[model samples]
Target: MFSSKTLAEMDRNIAKYPPEQKQSAVMACLIAAQEEHGWVSPAIIAEVAGILDMPTIAVEEVATFYNMYETKPIGQFKLVICTNLPCQLSHGEEAADYLKKKLGINFNETTSCGTFTLKEGECMGVCGDSPVLLVNNHRMCSFMSHDKIDALLDELKSQAKKGVSA
Candidate 1:
């Protein structure tokens, strides 16, 4: 379920398409729902399908197909590191390993405090910015050397201490 504000946002997204083609707004609606709920659950998917006049399975298909959509609950800060071939050659693996060591969690694992989740991701389309890390699927940190990575971790930890979302 979503808040009224999120529902209003979804309505706005639906309004972008013709009345008869409102189903085209499925992705936007799902994104709005995920933003509110932090993940796309089956009930949320069904609700989105109902709003868009789509089948629940269709909405599920979209959510499952996109790596950006979190079907399962994730930690507050989702750290997705790019590990494609180009990035791997540019210390992406090194960055990933450092994160694992620093966080004491491997890929697809969340920290015990539930403050951070680390995931290995595909190319973020910025090969030049290898060792790029995406925070909560939005903020992008590129050219992550060891010092930079340490600074980032400290900043995130500080944010967590301050009860800030990053």
Candidate 2:
């Protein structure tokens, strides 16, 4: 279900490990699969397991255990907010509230337009950068204030209009 380029990348991940320990590349393979499919499904999980010679359940377990992996379909943008203690103490709650109100979607929900998916994330190891969030699990957005949030939303919307990513 992935392009040749993606398949080659997965092979590279497998090569990083010993031949007998090909399963070691499961996590990286799952990430690549998710990047291609946008979410992990039963079929994709099975494919990854087959490639790595692992049990399907084992691959599914890794995907489910990590918040970064989306098991269900998500919008064009996945907004993950860090609500850990330090972040909560530093305006994270306020930022989350604003995002919910603005997107009209609660945690673990996606907007009607399928433009954004809101998720609550664990600590991202940047306490000093409280009110932090991640876009698509790759872009770390720190110091998220109301105005910054608004700007981000606007920027994302504009990108969506152009069929691009921010």
Candidate 3:
């Protein structure tokens, strides 16, 4: 269910590299597929392999290795809570607990309203701002407070309900 624009973008990405190097475009193609469907299906991965003249296993490797690739349905917004050492030291698990308590959904689960999905991620490279959480892949730079998380969760719900961002 990929759109023409996305296919064209993938083709352009392929053109940017030599024909023999289509493997280099694997990441872009997978991302394009992900953007269209929110998750990468096995069928699409096989199609990508055929498009790139590579093996399906090669495509799967790329998809599984990358943190950005999602294999399951995520909500309209994905709240990835970083729980690595730096984040934990800075109250990362606390934020995750807050989300679970507030949204009534644990890690790797979507909220009952389908407005948000909570994912447990590793260090998001914001050690300086250690307890960071990502919303729909957008880096939210501050953390350290449960109220901020409550506001974020509330805003996401409001946005989903209205079909507009809050």
Name the top TM-score candidate. 2
Over 4 Å off in model 1, which ranges? none
Cα lDDT tens digits for candidate 3, 72-127? 77788888888889888888888878888888888889977677888888877878
Weakest 10 consecutive residues of candidate 2 by summed lDDT: 157-166
RMSD, one per candidate, in order: 1.0, 0.8, 1.8
Q: lDDT per prediction?
A: 0.92, 0.93, 0.83
lDDT of 2 by residue, 1-166 (tens): 8899889999999999999999999999999998888888889999999999999999999999987788999999999999999999999999999999999999999999989999999999999999999999889999999999999999999998888764
Model 1 C-alpha lDDT per residue in residues 40-70, reported as the tens digit of each score: 9999999999988898999999999989898
Ranking by lDDT: 2, 1, 3
- lDDT score, residue 93, model 3? 84
| Error in Å for residue 87 of model 3 | 1.3
lDDT of 2 at 1: 81
The TM-score, computed over Cα atoms with residue i paired to residue i, of candidate 2 is 0.97
